[model samples]
Target chain A: MTENSDTLGATEKEIMYATHHAMVKSGYAELSISRISDELDKAKSTIYHYYDSKDALLLDFLRFSIDRFESTVNTTIGAHPKGDLDHIILTLLPCQLKKEKRQLHCVLVNIMPHALDQEAFREQFTEIDNRLKTIIEKTVRRGVRTNVFRDVDPAQAAEHILAVIKGAMCTRLTTNREAATARARTSLFSYIDSHLMA
Target chain B: MTENSDTLGATEKEIMYATHHAMVKSGYAELSISRISDELDKAKSTIYHYYDSKDALLLDFLRFSIDRFESTVNTTIGAHPKGDLDHIILTLLPCQLKKEKRQLHCVLVNIMPHALDQEAFREQFTEIDNRLKTIIEKTVRRGVRTNVFRDVDPAQAAEHILAVIKGAMCTRLTTNREAATARARTSLFSYIDSHLMA
Candidate 1:
């Protein structure tokens, strides 16, 4: 195996991937180590060896999810025109409509309640949220400078945007994902256009 | 005991009450019949007599929480004039700021992830959410007719309002409850005012 591959062995990676799949399928509350081990054809001890406890396993999976989300957003933005704020928002949101992304969001929101209960998890989740908020804030500020967005407070606008995205995620998880995504994009674009400075 | 009192004996009430307390203190995931029985100094069978299973017990608690939320919102609105939409929105939000209301929200949001996994729970939760959305939509429409709100689509506005409330709840659960609650209320009211006809 390559050096990088040896650092994160196939078994460990498989375990993390399996856990993520299980969480997305059944939710965090219903996930069990035994089920994961059964799927991986590994003993429970092996899973425990990789992760001290179920919480540890979950925390690792959440961290991985956040990292993947950040990368995906960044890559999508990087591949497009840098200063197209509307395009950036439009592109990033539709990604949520994808099967994998939707599942990831399900797992994220599902774990949120428990995450709030754990100090470490709460801090980590908040950190990720703040980072995302900062990105949106910066984007909105850029839009304002270019007269693409109105002179509203960037922080507040960012919060509103985030709220819409989160709400859309919840609605999508419960109902038709395609319809919810379409509505969210339409509503969001309308809000942006209406609020933008001519 | 009176006939009405005899129907729900002291022990049954004690078990239910204890279960509620346990959910508030430790969350729904930590709740179990044995734990409730232990807390109430009753036998497991005695607790089972009141609830068929842990799922049923939790479902009852969830229903109770939803009812309390609905009643609180209604009561808050009723305390003011019928057409005073501003007062209604402002009054209803602060009720969520209270400790008890926040706890109930915690439980509600927490169970959403598992809703898909549990058919009965999902149906109950969906009904509650739909009812809440309807109430908001009706209030917004009334505000529009009375010139208290702008000519914006009532359904969209209602959904946005619900989104803000859910976002605020998540923020409160993840961070400082008081601060999140205050900020959420202020932002929501401001958005409403900004959109209303001058």
Candidate 2:
């Protein structure tokens, strides 16, 4: 068994990758592990050995998603000078540049309520939400201090921005990507310009 | 069977009502029909008779929700003058005054994606989305023609407004209602006023 496990090659990796993608796209609630096993032409026990349960697999997928999002946003925002709220927001909010980010947005909007209802997942979700909120709040506060943004409440503004970004991404998930991108960018910039202090 | 159904009476109605509330709060994907039946102290068959499948049951709940929201918005907006966009927007957006509207907002934000995946439910969801968008577009066009709004693309602006309203409602669903209401109203009015002709 150890030798077989050692020889488990690219096919096993492909199977797990496919399972994760399917789960993210359709949701874990609707996903069937047996179907995933069948798709991979792997034994159920082998799949079970890789993931203790569907919930465990979902958690892994979510962790990967959260990390990727945090890193992407960090890289995009960090590329610009600090306190450039418009640049930071423009980079993060639009769904055109990154497919993974859009998928993450869909999962976030669709899976969050169910995730919140689960006792084990509640704290993890709360932490992630707060972390994202904190990043936006900090940027808004910086903009206010620099007179780039009006004297709006940073926390409230951050929440609103996040909501709009999420909503725009949700719209894109079901509509034409190019059109959604254009509309989202225009609307977001118009909003920022209108809201910012002269 | 008809006599037995008649005998079931208000009890079944009460059970369905409770289940509907629970489904809205938790979402149809996560709702437990068995638990709902247990709570009602009724056989699952009784519930099944009224709702042939979970999809049917959820669709019924959604239909009830759509009717309630449409009526509430129509009545609230009708009470004001004919071309008052701000009044119409304020009345239509989910807030504390209309608890049912808030619940419907939750259902839309949480369940619409799952409904989109179901063939039977997709048309209904699309109809509701298109109907709401058309109404807003018509109002924006009226506002522009009356010289109340600036020379903007009415369809794009209408979609943006819908995005913001829906975004705000999604925020309200996940956070404190009072704060969410205050922020949504402020942002909404600000957006509308900024676009109006001076």
Candidate 3:
């Protein structure tokens, strides 16, 4: 699959956009090609021509969403390692995404339960997670090189960071517990300060 | 609404058992009153006699599961503060659950997305989360009083600890990535050692 939306053909892009709107409106369980087609203002046959099933369409939507996040990272990431790390944290946490993209995060949250039983969906999620972890790992490595971070296992640090982000996202989105996420964010930064900072 | 399973009548307990099996077998999306009846080897009308809707039944099922967890914690929590904290941590984490209870956790994970749009479901989840957080907060407070732990904000510490547990649960369950959970567990214990240890 293409790494970013830059390489997607116009029709594929249209399909992805339709899928996003449909998922945000109807959620993943209720999402169907008919709903996506209605959003596309196109026929179901058109979606079938491109994707054999709704799962195929959703897999592409997952890629589309991740590519959008990659673009966000490209724009938001700074040369400063701490800034880069903080931006990444904010990006993953709920309520920080652009208003439009916030719905996309909800869609991802909706798809997570689906991944528990769907192997293809689970693999895509794993890939998305690994890519995010790698971004954090690289940032930690950069911080270590600059002497801003202590000598620590970058991979371990990345895992812990992403785990807390996932937790905060889940807690905030599912329970609407903003204070819990706030507390988690403080705890995470404190961990960085004590363990990762020099 | 009962705090534990002891208050549940025999029929209610039977319905809960049927629900556990049905949810584990079918997952939440496909769960139905009819399937639960099949598990009970009783008529669908019997289930409907007690609960008006599938959502109602599932809500009770959530309470049943939480009550089971409370029972486990009641038995497992030790007199020692550190042991109490560690037991709670292990209880919340994925792999450490009893074999039968693991499927129950999977059912909770499956039910999570349903909470996104359903108010009843969301309220139950929030209640469950609040209860767990309170347990952790109490544990931390006890630890601090006995000088086994530093004087940390018990609520903040509890939130952070639960967040990491949630992150580890999601990572392990969704991605099947044991190593990620392992790293998170280590990071979590390290956090406790540095921040909470007196």
After superposition, which runs of candidate 3 have C-alpha atoms over 4 Å from their true positions?
A1-8, A24-30, A74-77, A94-98, B1-7, B25-30, B94-99
User: How well is each residue in A10-129 modelled by candidate 2, as lDDT tens digits?
Assistant: 655555566666655655455677867766677878777767887665555555565556655655444222335555566566545565555556566556565434644544454455
Error of 1 at A77 (Å): 3.9
Question: What TM-score would chain B receive for each of the candidates shown?
Answer: 0.75, 0.68, 0.89
Off by over 4 Å in 2: A1-64, A77-102, A119-128, A147-153, A174-181, B1-52, B60-64, B76-103, B175-181
Model 3: native contacts recovered, as a fraction: 0.60
Would you list the clashing residue pairs of candidate 3?
none
Docking class of 2: acceptable
Counted clashes in each candidate structure: 0, 0, 0
lDDT of model 1 at position B171: 68
Q: Against the true structure, what is each candidate's TM-score? A: 0.79, 0.68, 0.91
Candidate 1 lDDT by residue in tens digits, A1-198: 002222457788889787877766665666899878866777999998888888777776766666667656554443222244555456456744676666777777677776657876786667566656667777777767766666777777777766666666566565332444565556666566555444
Candidate ranking under DockQ, highest first, comes to 3, 1, 2
Q: TM-score of the A chain in candidate 3? A: 0.88
Which tens-of-lDDT digit does each residue in B1-198 have in candidate 1? 001223446665576678777766776677788878777887899877778887776766666556656665665444322344455455455644566555666777767776745666766656665666677778777777776666778777666666666665576676433444565566566676666444
Instruction: Judge candidate 3 at residue A188 and give its lDDT.
Output: 76
Q: Which rank order by TM-score, best down to worst?
A: 3, 1, 2
Best by DockQ: 3
